[model samples]
Target: MSDSSFSGFVQSFKKLAVDTLSIREGSDPEATIEGIKKDMTFKGHAAWILIFSILIASIGLNSNSPAVIIGAMLISPLMGPILGIGTAIGIHDVDMMRRALKNIAIAVVISLVTSTLYFSISPITIEQSEILARTKPTILDVFVAMFGGFSGIIAGSRKEKSNVIPGVAIATALMPPLCTAGFGLATGTYKFFFGAFYLFFINSVFITLSTYIVVKYLRFPIKKFIDRSKYRRYRSLLIIFLTIIVMPSGVIFMNMIQETRFKIAVDNFINDNTVFQGSELLTQKIVYTDTLSTIDLYYMGKNIDENKIIFLNEMLARYGLNAKAGEYFPLTKKTLVRIHQEDGSGADIDKKFAEYSNDLHSKLLRDIYTKNDEVIRDKDLKIKLLEKRIYNLNASKKDPYPVQQLNKELKFQYPEVEKYAITSIQLQEFEGDSLKVIKHPVLLVKLSDTVTDEQRPEYLGKIEKWIRIRLNDPKLKVYKF
Candidate 1:
């Protein structure tokens, strides 16, 4: 291509980019400033709306309902004063800034008081996931606030308004954190209170910063002009404030990333090392922390040998999970592998396995319901039919009893025993004129001729105890023939 043609193409591309990205084309700065001023005051309808939204948000957080929280966000007027503060800063209007700050202070107090009252009286006082999520502010939330603020200001300045402001309100999530802070106060959890209030502060500062940037970029006419020295001083103060606000979130985000990576590595290690010859990996628990981390492996069927445990520990180094003698490992100081094995006594092992299975099942159902509620609502009948079919299929399956293994175990433990048979029997009884049938397991054993009649009762008692404990059945009967 010729130089002239390339230059022309570059110029055309630049024009297209500018036209597409520009927000100054249809902006009404004067109208936007007036509108912000109008909305900045907290009184009458706005005050009542703020209180109602606080109540809604508190209830949503209490119940851990995302939909209800979103509804509350839509009606929240908290963003008005925040935008006013940013606009005031952009135009250098000290009066406007004072009014905005005062109103925002009032709004915050009202929100905290109202939410605290609701949470105090609310029966469900448990810390829900939704409330807990707002207590941590990361760099990702900073970006959300920034972009949401940008969209909010741009949409507000436009002559033809759009739904972007409400969308921004939801994205920034300015209401939930306040309610969470209130919950923390009510419950006397200082950690939650400080963390949630810090999150709210982060959102407020970043949104104000974003709005100020947009307003200055559009060259909104200043209400008061100051000397360059004073302007520079103000700018420097703003920069310092922003830096202070952002530093903690940056650290938090880095920690989150490290934790996420560690978890992925742990998962991979578990998957690769799960295939042991005689043992089965029933469940695994991973606890991660900056100071130390631990991985607990629960197995059944056979004990893992020392050599295998040593090898697994050695493999941890390959995954960058091993503890170094003198190194600053921020993700974790050391990764400890604790192995739990099922012995001949099956109660503890069986109980742990059952708990793990139940937890996994509950998590699966929660995820399915949360992510597919709309789809499930549309096909409720189909889902019910499928559930019924699943229940029937499960009911039709035979009870999982290893008769051959139990027989072998019986023979090994009792040398004189030749064979054994086990069966489930129903006993019919009449209780207050009503007939009841109860099912119990019956075990029958055949012994060798060397076993005398005197030893029969003792052997029966011992065998009965063994079978009952092994099968986890209290109502089991044993007979010797």
Candidate 2:
């Protein structure tokens, strides 16, 4: 061979070798993985799987069913594209990476759109614990995705792999977040969208990277690969583009870490200083008001002490936080105390009533005063008439009429009465414009004996007005006979 021809031949051989290696390196492992993915026939299987999983997840979130949620996670088919992207990147196979990313994006958009469609018409609101839980991603979620991807790649590459795909699916939790994204989309909850989409983004990036690492480690080659200088430049540009795209996500990941830490600090402060020691704090919410800070902590019970407040204030001072702390005990519990006075008579009615009234007013939101200017005692009085055993006389309606609805307005009419227990309500059926009648026959209103019979009509008049307003009929009458 001539010198020129020999040199050309050597160059050609080198190019061939590189091309062969690129093709093998880029195409081999993915070929194996892709074969399995392809074997998943049943047209639109992925679409169907995604659709079903989202439905289950949405229902689970609405119903607060953890087991159903886990099942949905297992059935989700989202990891296939995510891992594909990672493998493509690691092996430096631009084409494969593009395909993988496309698939991933398509799957996500489909899942989210499907979920949004389902939730939009499902008649369920986005108020469940699981829905709220996934709406906020912590650093812990990133860690989970990273580990899950690492494990997923390992399992996907193995022959006769033990249900690792399912394990990976559960660990990565791709579906739940997408379902939550749907919830956010439908409910117009921007926070939910922010957190859930961040989580999905984290999983996509870390999983693809992990898959790349695994594919490289496996030495999978791209088949029929052709490398050109122009392609190299293009590849570099794509890498730079992807990096730029992900830069903002890194910022979000950092913010999530900081926010999580702040919440932990607040909880710790509440637990260490509050009277609710060893109690499970139900909810700890921090709100930044326009001019002040508000920290609302709801506990399981209503056990508070004054000393705890002082201690909490000190903690807030240390953090340079000025906030108001409010505690609500169980609705059933009353802190109001009533005092009674006997005016050389039966039960020191004046003095006792004055003490009780003062305690109630102090604990309640409003103050209570009487025209007589006499102090009233605080007592939970249940009228015997309200608790009377009355039978249902009218068979027109069901077993019992709405007694609670009937008596809600009783509060304003009978401020002197602390509580009323409805013993029975008489329902009468009429053929004319009268729909129904509710009679509270034996209501023994609790009042001081000092209250004259003439004053009784005023309270009764208020009760009558309340009933008239609730019935929405001016002619509807209550016969106290």
Candidate 3:
């Protein structure tokens, strides 16, 4: 382990690292500049491509289709001017920076105008999910723009550029914000216009700034302005430009994080606390600002009382998301509601009426159900009694009281009949589409002495008519044996 060998090992390791990680500017400087300048040009073809891309992106955002959005991103010429601006700043070329800026302005104006015109007559005014997703620029969007810019510059500087440029274009999402802004303008909503444009501005500025950092780090030969003061002035301007671009986004990201935390905490609180049995939370809204922080929830089903609501409020305080100034009491100016409640707005009146109508309908159904049960019970009792009586009559059917009465009447009247019997006949009757077995009374009579047909007929007729009247069935027929 002599000094020479140790130094040799160290140098060898350094060489290996450099070979693995080194990114050289192999493309000729003049050739590279020429290529960038070509892209930076605001030509007719570039303008048409940007316009068509704007229309495609606007339609995609309007429909909330991610695939269409990616297609638009791949075909967009918007990235050229933006990258040109970054490359100019990276090499400290003021004239190139000016040209890039001018081209970028043209691209932006064309994009905005094209999208606005498309949205104006397209008849789809409703904002889609994709459109809304671009309205807010978060800290994550900042990171994405920075990384995309870094990748774009690295790929562009290489002698043979790969598909990384297209990937950066899609990941950075440069076109969507402009188109979303157009939708907002068409719909007469300044909120969308401002928010989306802010996001687009962030992407463009950060991408340019990232490219400048890379170029400076790579130590690309500076343009070397005749006036050193001009170089310092441009450097200072770039710093100020980045600072101004990033500050608002930082504040916005912090607010977004706070809002996200509030939403998560509120959702957990609502789900964990059983404010009412079978209660369902329909909506939760939070208004978080320096002066005011409040959570409003809308729910349906069984409502929780004030005491339980107060307990739930205490839970919100535990999460450090809510601060209470006074005790909550119902019918007071300030109160906390853990269930279906209103702030005395006119909208609550309609809600109350709907609730009242639902209650009335439920009560009416309950009453009808009770009446139906009583009617069914009474009818069941009558059927049971009739079945019991029929069973007893059928058991003594051979010589029942009705048979004895018939015999006594026949013997006292003419003494022509000897024996008589009563039996039931079960016959299948077709009632509508159904076949039913029905039970009916049948009388069988036997004469003691020999009698002619005419005399037999007279006796049978008299007995059958009498039995028919007693049985209350005039359709009864008699048989002589």
Candidate 4:
């Protein structure tokens, strides 16, 4: 193609891109700033709204209801003061900044008081998953807050506002974390309180930062200008404050990543090496920590020998879980392996079987069963077979006949009988043209010389009846010696 035609095509594409991406068209900066200022006051209606929203958010978190939490976020007046702070910073308006800060503090106090009261008096003390989720702030949450703030400010600056504000409110999730902090305070779980409060702080700061960026990009008119020296000082302080806020989240994200990798490695190790000749891995627990990690394996059917455990521990180095002596690497933290064996005893087997059966009946297992019904069925079959084998082995180890008890009872009933023995004997019989072997319970009794021959047959018949009744075996035989 000729240079002139190529240049024309490039210009056309650039024009289209600019037109599609531009935020300047139909912008209302003055109106947006005024709206933010108007919403910065925490008055009669706003204060009540904040209190009610906090209560709603707390209830939603306690109930573990995502939809309800989203609803509370949509109705919350929290974004107003936050947005006001950002706008004030953008325009260098000291008075507006003061008002925004004051209103935000009021909102925070009201939220905490309302949520704490509700959670304290409410009978539900359990920390639901929804509440627990907000207790940690990660780098991903920072991105969510920043992007949500950008969308919110851009949407607010438009001549025709859409539903972006409510969506942004849900995305940023400003209210739930505060409510979770209140829950922590009420429940006396300080870890939850600090973690949740830090999360809330992160969201607020990142949202404010994003708003300031967008406001500057949109070139909102400055209300006042400070001296250059004061500006530099404020900038330095802001950088330091942001660093403090963000460093912890960055560390948390790194830890989360490391934990995820460790779990994956552990899963691979378990799947590959957990199998033994006669043992079944019933359950496993993996605990990951910075200092030391641990893997606890629970086995059923047979006990894993010490040699195998030592070998498995040696294999930990392949998974990057075992550290060399004097090593100080982060991922090289030493992991301890503990193997708990059930030995397939009757009581232990029964307990583990009951636990597995209960798990199969649970809602989570039902959902998983829907996806892997065949695999679960196969596992169930294996468990049943193992249980049967264990039961059979246990039966063999136990005495089938209680000779001591039977001898005592016989001696008490018949004073002439000195002692007795019982056992299972195989007898051969001819049935038509085939020889068959049948097993039967046999009882042998030795009588005192005081008993004459005449009393022998009579005592033998009575003893046979008594033995049949006592042992509940109709096919038992009795003899006297």
Candidate 5:
């Protein structure tokens, strides 16, 4: 390529860069300031809008609805005062700064108050995941707030209004934290109040700082205040705020890292120090929130003091989880076993073995005895039930049926027969005065009132034969009633 052609290409790229990067070119600072002031005034319509937006956000958080939260963010007037504060600080406008601070205070108080009232009245008391998520602020929130503030001012300075402001509101998420803080207030869970409020504070402060930086970068004309010492306090207050907000956020981030590291260390310790080869590590419960960290491991065939206990103490120190020498060993008792170990002090081991063996033997004997008793009881119950069944069968056989299904069938077949009954008889007699009896099952049937009167004897004979055939006893007896 020719040098002239290369220079022309470079110039074209530079022009593109300048055109893309220039924010002040199309921006009117005075118009932007007036627009922000109009937005920053929190009274009448703005106050009502803020109040309603807070309620919507509270409902969203309570119901775990992300879409509702986004709607609330879009309608929220919170970004107005926050951006106003940022702009005021950026341009060194003391009057605007005072107004911005006052308006922001009003918005915050109203937001917190409105949300608190709504949450208190709401029937859904359980903390939803959406609300719970906002309670824990991370470093990511810092970036969101800063970027949102920066973009907000850039968009505000433009000649044509865009969707960027609403997008920033949703991205910064000012409403959710306030609603979450309200939840904490309603439920008496002060941690939620502190954590969520801190998140909101972080978003607001960083956003204001970003606006200040952007305005300063744009080199907009600064407002000269009449009282220098009074305005100086504002700068001092900003510094104080930076210390307060940044310190806690940094501390929380560090604690989160520590907690995560503690979990990994615990997991590694368990995986590496399984008591024996074929032993399974079932589950572990580790609490590392407070100064004293605890780990409870559930497993079988693992000896505590040999490797586990000593190793756990070492891990706590290695991972900075605050392990004590003798007091804070991981496991105190075996998870699934009750027997004492034979730790090879000859006599002591023997004594422990003896006790464990005796206990095992006693338990085995008790179980065997209990099982035997159950089996015996079951057999007795079965015998009683069987005897009762036999008695019922005998009784049923001897007595005639009170309402006979067979008689109904017979009556249907032979409608001339008015009534019918059959009783089982044991055919028995004394043989040659020997006082002994022989017996056979014979069905004795009685019939009465034939419908045709002309066939009584004939019907009786037919019925007797039918009864004998049906009973499977040719020796069945027939009688008239």
Candidate 6:
């Protein structure tokens, strides 16, 4: 293509794009705004559209359904008045601006009231992550609203066909804020209401400003407006100036303070806990999930003595942390003992166990199960072998057996005898008793809080040996978990 042809094509595209987006500035901007208000079928069409969209949004918020919320946003007629306001302000149309403001206020109040009423009567009390997530506003949110509004106006005012309106709807997220307003009402939370309303306010202001700029760029006739009053023009200028100068700075300052506080807390935690030499600090997750606060500190590597842990606890207590931390010790990594048994009973079992156990070494390393890459589930053959062990354990009531108190905290895969017999048994409290015969041989085991399925055998072996001595039956057979 020739240079002139390419230049002409570029000019044509620019003109088309400009004409599509720009609403021309006029002399009597107020009169133009009033004309728009008069033409808006508010009571008949716009009212119903607004109500329907708000209703959809309310339901989406209650259900925590993103798809439903997006649908509501797409159909919302509320954006029209907001854009009108922006357009009016940009071209100094005070009357249209006032009317648009009134409409927006009414729309917000109606949406909030209706949503609140619906949520209050609804039986759903579970607050979903989606609903909670939207309640907080940050600098990122402000930026999103501003850019989204800009894009929305550009897409909406275009003459040539494009699905830009939907994009605008998504970017603005008009429905969620209203739904959040409803959630506040339902839960009777002033914080929710405040945050949501502020978000709505931001979006409305940004959208209007964007629309006003676009309209001015389009050269909408200012002199053709209906409400040609001097006072209206002054009011429009004041509002437009204040919005341009004040809001963005305030939002930025608030976000900065919040981020600074969060960083301080994280840094303090890391600095305070760096003294433990043997233990490898895994993670410190400061999660803001529920309204309530919590901090989770995960530690891996070697176990220090109880004295060190107590000292650490004292340090944490200074920070007002009272939660009890848990500890875990894996035998393969933390201990020196390891025993392997051969399957054939006729073979030299003791010799084999000693030989296999002699190869064991203890290294200060993280437990394999704690890592993300570990696959710890038993194979089908192993599961079947375990089943066979339970089936093969044959001891009857005639055999001398021990009566031991079971811990109430432990849940058994098989039906626990305590569940059937000891309704008032104390949790974690076991009482030694006289030996008693059982229908079948039973295995007794103790569980550490952090033990995975793979580590069960070593711990169970000790328990099984203890139980054997307590029963006074060397021949009594049982499978340990």
**What overall lDDT goes with each candidate model?**
0.84, 0.60, 0.73, 0.83, 0.72, 0.57
| Better by lDDT, candidate 6 or 4 | 4
Superposing every Cα of model 1 onto the true structure, what RMSD results?
Answer: 18.7
Ranking by lDDT: 1, 4, 3, 5, 2, 6
lDDT of 2 by residue, 24-92 (tens): 333346545675345322238777887888889888877779899999988887777677666555555
Show how many residue pairs clash in every candidate, following the order shown.
0, 38, 0, 0, 0, 23
Better model by TM-score: candidate 2 vs candidate 4: 4
Residue pairs with colliding backbones in model 5 are none
The TM-score leader among the candidates is: 4
Clashing pairs in 3: none
Report the C-alpha displacement of residue 440, candidate 6, in angstroms.
40
lDDT of 5 by residue, 1-481 (tens): 9999999999999999999998878777888888998998889988999998898888888888999999999999888888888888777787898999998898888988988888876756776668878888988789889989999988888878788999999999999999999999989999999999999999999999988888877776788644779768877997897887788778777777767766676666656654544333334445566355566554433344555456555544444345446654332211121123323333332343446664644333233233442343244343454455555555666664423446556766666655555655555566786665544444344445434457666767887787767766787666666
Candidate 3, 52-160: lDDT as tens digits:
8888898899787899999999988877878778778667688988999999999888888999898886645666668878888877888999999988877777777
Could you tell me the TM-score of candidate 6?
0.49
How high is the lDDT of residue 243 in model 4?
Answer: 88
Off by over 4 Å in 4: 324-332, 343-481
- lDDT string for model 4 (1-481, tens) is 9999999999999999999999878788999999999877889988888888888888899888999899899999899989999999999988999999999999888888888899887756776778878887899999999999999999999989888988998999999988998998899998898999898889999899999998999999999988999989999999999988899999999888888888888888888888887676656667789778998886767667899999899999898887667765555478888998654643444555556664533323333324342444244444454455455555555757765455557766888888777788889999999999999888889989888899898989998998899989999999976
Ordered list by TM-score, greatest first:
4, 1, 3, 5, 2, 6
Worst 10 residues of 2 by lDDT: 329-338
lDDT of 1: 0.84
Which stretches of model 5 miss by more than 4 angstroms? Answer: 1-15, 221-237, 274-282, 298-481
The candidate, 5 or 6, that scores higher on lDDT is 5
TM-score of 5: 0.59
* Model 6: per-residue Cα lDDT at residue 260: 49
Off by over 4 Å in 2: 1-31, 36-42, 90-102, 224-285, 288-292, 296-315, 319-481
